[model samples]
Target: MIQPLSMRGRHAVVLLVEDNEDHVFLTRASFEEAKLQIDMRHVDDGAKCLAFLRKQPPYEDAPSPDLVLLDIHMPRMDGYEVLDAIVKDDALRHLPVIVLTTSAEALDIERMYGMRCSSYIAKPLDFESFTKAVAQLAGYWLNLVVVPHRDG
Candidate 1:
């Protein structure tokens, strides 16, 4: 078992860009089950994800996320398009975006890495595996990694 590192008295803020409500539920539940304290914000599609990141209109008061967990397929825009936009913008480029999707295709992995995604995770099919995966992800990113602090 991996021990958690101190977060300097603050919790990690994670932005989840996914279209499926079930996935959203699973993600939140997994964190809760793992006893990880992460402040998660959700956006259903890539367009909304961009809006939240850019702090536009309704999302103007949204907090800048410490990390992003993005899904590959969605309405309005896909993950690839979102990744492209993030990479091109100087303000958003510094943020670490992890591609979390069901697709484990080599081509998809190569494409995401080529686009400069911080990580690519092939989501597991079973509930137990999914929970474990989420726990590991949180443990690594929020506890083990020393990410630079930035405010939006």
Candidate 2:
């Protein structure tokens, strides 16, 4: 079935790297009401995020994401490693990565910044607030920001 309008003009593809099912649900719900169209695709672990970015098997047809919503903790290849890989890759480095995690540890924030992630926001403890935050965060980056072209 065809989905209702979720975005207005240009299609914004987002790769959400989150292991938790609840978080993913909230994120998807928020995007459904966003002012612009967002093509949100999800991967449960950082490893799949890497594979998607690399266009590896089973993801060979995945389009390059306009933005990445990353969670720090996962089963394999945590967010830190994914951020590192993106920064190290010339073709993928231009895509923006936003760390959306629960931990407020200074070291994690500092480390992600050092690794050249685009932004970092701690996930709110409550679901309502978290959903709003996700929408605003995504809206800002996907709608307002004029990011560099991801196609290289």
Candidate 3:
């Protein structure tokens, strides 16, 4: 349901926090067919996600992402912790974050919403379906919605 608009606007940066390499690859592949230009970065864990957003040591020069795709379960820190941190941080709270996880439990979805995530999506098991879902999601959020500029 995406309207065909000029996809040449400012490149939207997306940070994907996923520990699974295969899921990361699938997301990358899905973006290949996007109608809008996007700059996607991948972090393996919640801790790294926070680090990337905070411009910490290794990620000091990392740009602030317009959107974030977060995974629930990760070593060191979980998505809940990252979400908590984001909500608490004055600099990062305004950024939109979408929860991407395998759990479709009502509690999980509710909890994510309670934490003020922009959206909650469960990963599809089928590759084709997964790709399609991601495409649709990307289309809706990136193409249809207006992304706000991040103030320094």
TM-scores of the candidates are: 0.94, 0.88, 0.90
Q: Model 2 over residues 1-152: C-alpha lDDT tens digits?
A: 22212333457788999999998987887767544467889999988999999999789999888889999999979998999999998888988899999989999999999999899999887767876887778667865777766542
Of the two candidates 1 and 2, the one with more favorable lDDT, higher being better, is: 1
What residue runs in model 1 are displaced by over 4 Å at the alpha carbon?
Answer: 1-6
Residue-wise C-alpha lDDT for candidate 3, range 27-115, written one tens digit per residue: 88877854447789999999999999999979998988888999998899999999999999988998889998899999999999999
Q: List the residue pairs that clash in candidate 3.
A: none
Q: How far is candidate 3 from the true structure (C-alpha RMSD, Å)?
A: 3.4
lDDT of 1 by residue, 1-152 (tens): 22233455767789999999999999899889999888899999999999999999789999998889999999999999999999999889988899999999999999999999999999998888999999989888888877665677
| Candidate 2, run of 10 with poorest lDDT | 1-10
Candidate 3 residue runs with Cα over 4 Å from true position? 1-8
- Highest-lDDT candidate: 1
lDDT of 3 at 62: 94
